[model samples]
Target: MVCVEEYAVRVLVTGGAGYIGSHVVRSLQGSGHTVAVLDDFSTGSRRRVGADVPVEDGSLLDTAFVEASLRRLSADAVVHIAAKKAVEESVADPLFYYRENVAGMQSVLEAMVSAGTRRLLFSSSAAVYGASATSPVTETSPTDPSSPYGWTKLMCEQMIRDVSLAHGLSWSALRYFNVAGAADPTLADRGESNLIPKVFRAISSGVRPQIYGDTYPTPDGSCLRDYIHVNDVADAHATVLEHMENADLCTVYNIGTGTGTSVFDVMTAVRLVTGVDFECDICPPRPGDPADVVADPAKIRAELGWASQYDLGSAVESAWKAWSDAPS
Candidate 1:
């Protein structure tokens, strides 16, 4: 069994003010862990994390600031979540992605080494798997990234593995599929940049949402994705942190619901939940987008005892509630 309190882990969460990172910070705090947030406020907002948590306002690119924050927080483990995550934007500017995602990670690694903090949980993506013939991808699947964003994630995974092997740093890279939905109302905030939220925004504003590429080979010809709830993703992070002692020096796990939901299915769920009649305009497929990308979460389930509780409907309902209740 993993004993988190035995070590009394103090966690330093980079990008804790962002959408997914904020949820992770909330989950960590709920689990009785000391949490310190490091965010640049570039793509993240301090309001997302609220005022209770200490927010170290700085960029991960600044090695000095990151090292200083680690020393001041005296963090035992680091959950690195800061990265430029827009796939389309990355395709437009590959160099920016490399500098922010890859180089920023290198700085964080150096800071961790300096502070004697070894345990790390990295937020990877399904993009790393690219186009897979298999419906659901396993951790052992071949990585053939089709975009600059995907390539950056794969590069970071390799860097983490190398650092763990050479420097005795224990690491877990959670390769997440589509992280949709929102945290429960008690933890809701307005700053998120995912598909669900965008769709909600369109419906609320009396506009039809645009559907990218509805001609894919799926049940409804829309893109199919494994939509995991944000809370479930946060829970997985906490589970990994709690069970880090039992994990190997370098470990990778795919985090998802193990079921695929297409864009049409998600739209149907939204309409059912909100009673809103929204139209959609079919558009060409965005570059680097695969027809289907699901996850085989068996490895994570067996290794960390982590499983997703919310299904697609539940995820859509919760996300709708959040967007409807969002401050104007």
Candidate 2:
């Protein structure tokens, strides 16, 4: 609650049926904002998208659908969350990643301009700061994305800045760290790019959880990352959305807890929370994995008055509960 009034607006969230998008939509709706979803439904489904939320079943690449939807909803702002986000998948097929993530962003921006939607919150990623030179990455830290997926995010950030330079657009790019868990179990992350879901998938299959590359230079010889709950990520989205509306923002911020959790730390927490003791099988390191990446939220905290409320254990516990309850 940054304002005396809730600062409600008609928001259009792209990819609203997906995992992170769904939670963001929920957060926006809870804050008394009207919301509509535009999704292709390739990886997202109607069930995760609530019946109450209005939806336009279409692709972001299709400028016609995007323009029509923006005009139809008379959206006050747009939160661009639709992108292909898998590191390994991006490595395997870089062209597809570029075509979908980068090209789709272009289409969205064009549509927003066409529909007179000037405010936008772009879903950037910590992957933009690939590997880590500093322990706690600040907004001004050097960006050297090691993977194609990370590169796409960086490109989108540049696009936002360039677009704003040319057009009257107020935009913010929040570079997310690892987003996990859910506000509700039903809305828990279903994607397999993260540690929690991969651990769940492995353990449930009667195999030990696999930790890639235990030889990284870090405490306990494993990579460290900032794991923020999806709900907290969504809350940051709400905060940024309101912040964008109030002021001129052609800037970037890291969306993360100002702390780091190692892979081994997460495994222990998962075992403790699930009460299912399992060993971890250490494999070779992935190509682009950095030793560690933690966020310095000082800038965002002082400016936007935002911080992660949930701890890492709570996030893993919620995901485990959802994984256990759902049919795999």
Candidate 3:
């Protein structure tokens, strides 16, 4: 059992019933810290969270309810993970994305302020740097969000910074790039959208998997991305919580494997893992797809002493195992 140092403080995880959030909850519990989960079950499932933890079923947009919940729980720190995430969906409905991702973050910040919770670990995304110039983007890379979903994440980062400066809160925003694989077998059943899961589903069903735009400026003529195991991402969250007290206002870190793997490479790995060769259809590039996006994890390593345990092969293996073990 990987245990977090015994901290008597209680931690609250928003979107705790979701994939990444559920893993964070488990990590916290394993570390001997008490955890409370707040989720609306919009994209999250109640079954993902452990049966023992208290899960408040409500939306983060409900300010009063959020405030009441925080007050009642008397949480020591909050890990905000709930948000609208799909890039294409955000493009279709920017307003909905802003409402859920931006507005909901505001409500959570206000509630935390009211409840006297000054420490937070925000689950930010690398989408903020939509077509970044640097292959391995550092924390200081220019943020040129290309999609509505990315814009929402940037907006939330600004919110966290402002709140931290004004209210003397200590916060860390982890800009995650390609959070792939599953930590728990049960939670893996709820996986969606990510390239690994999509490919796994198609290969398992003996259907052709579609690969959009193969003529990109890469070795394999496919877009490149840094794939980080979900377990590593979860562990980084706990690391942030442990260092929250000493952290300055609003620190940011890039969480990734610091290596880029192309779509073709991923498919090749998938084929090797499943021992099943499937056809792949090449379609026009998706509207917001970037040519290459990786992360420079030096800041995270220096600041939190965090490192990824799984590489591309290990990541694909874990994801394959999760999908293989899941019930149909």
Candidate 4:
């Protein structure tokens, strides 16, 4: 299903060629929206953005370039998805995260203001919640992020809020959970930083996928996470954009299935989907890792009539097929 709106609007997606960005871009195209892409190609691809789509290759950090692109494309809305996203990498290099995520967001918003683009969809993360006391992290959860990456996301959210207040920009910040799976096989996550891709890499390399920790206090003694498909995430973006037509703006939403899946559970799904009876070894949990991280998507569902379509089995199955078939 395409996410193109009833009224034709020119939308520019920043980092529209990356893992999640590509899915959203395709959804926009399918829905009949006039879409353009602006990506630095740092960890993105021209193909993922679609060969026929208009793509402006440049850095989001360049305010002048971002401003020029928004003006040139006559963008009516901007979906900001370009940023540094690795949790571990952010820990090792907090300065880089601040420089890219926060500063880059500033550039995008300023450009939108310059071009008179009033609508926006900002890519946020569940990392902003850190370790929540509740089972299902809500939109109003305490946002005391433990890692620098989380801090960057939280800071960016604040920046977006401030920008909207000052510029009258209509925006939605979709705080994503453990985003997995693929809408298409070729667009399956190529970066191995994510769990699904990491497991696929291990299996293809003749190594057992390692469970970070099995000693956590959960049903399976492993960390439980809310894994949402890339397709569903894309769908949420489209739905929220539609909702903005005649509703309140500058709101935040948690994007997930509102259910928990353990690392062991995901491993089993990988085995089931791939038809490989592979064993996994348990290792110490990474620092700052929480026992359970789930979502309470009530706000988004009630507001936008959004619900996830893919279950764990379908998501894992599609992901394996994508990873297996995608060029190595």
Ranking by TM-score: 2, 4, 3, 1
Q: Tell me, by TM-score, which candidate is best.
A: 2
TM-score of every candidate relative to the true structure = 0.95, 0.97, 0.96, 0.96
Q: Select the stronger candidate by lDDT from 2 and 3.
A: 2
Ranking by lDDT: 2, 4, 1, 3
Candidate 1: residue 222 Cα off by (Å): 1.0
Give each model's clash number: 0, 0, 1, 4
Show the colliding residue pairs in model 2.
Answer: none
| Runs of candidate 2 exceeding 4 Å displacement | 2-6
Residue 251 local lDDT, model 3: 79
The number of the candidate with the highest lDDT is 2
Q: Residues 30-136, candidate 4: write the lDDT tens digits.
A: 76778999999999976686777898999998899998998988988898998888887888889999999999998898888888999999999988888654679
Error of 4 at 314 (Å): 0.7
Q: Compose the digit string of candidate 1's lDDT tens values, residues 53-73.
A: 888998999998999999998
Q: Candidate 1: lDDT over CA atoms? A: 0.86
What lDDT score goes with residue 255 in model 4? 95
The runs of at least 3 residues in candidate 4 whose Cα sits more than 4 Å from the true structure, single-residue gaps closed, are 1-5
Error of 4 at 124 (Å): 0.5
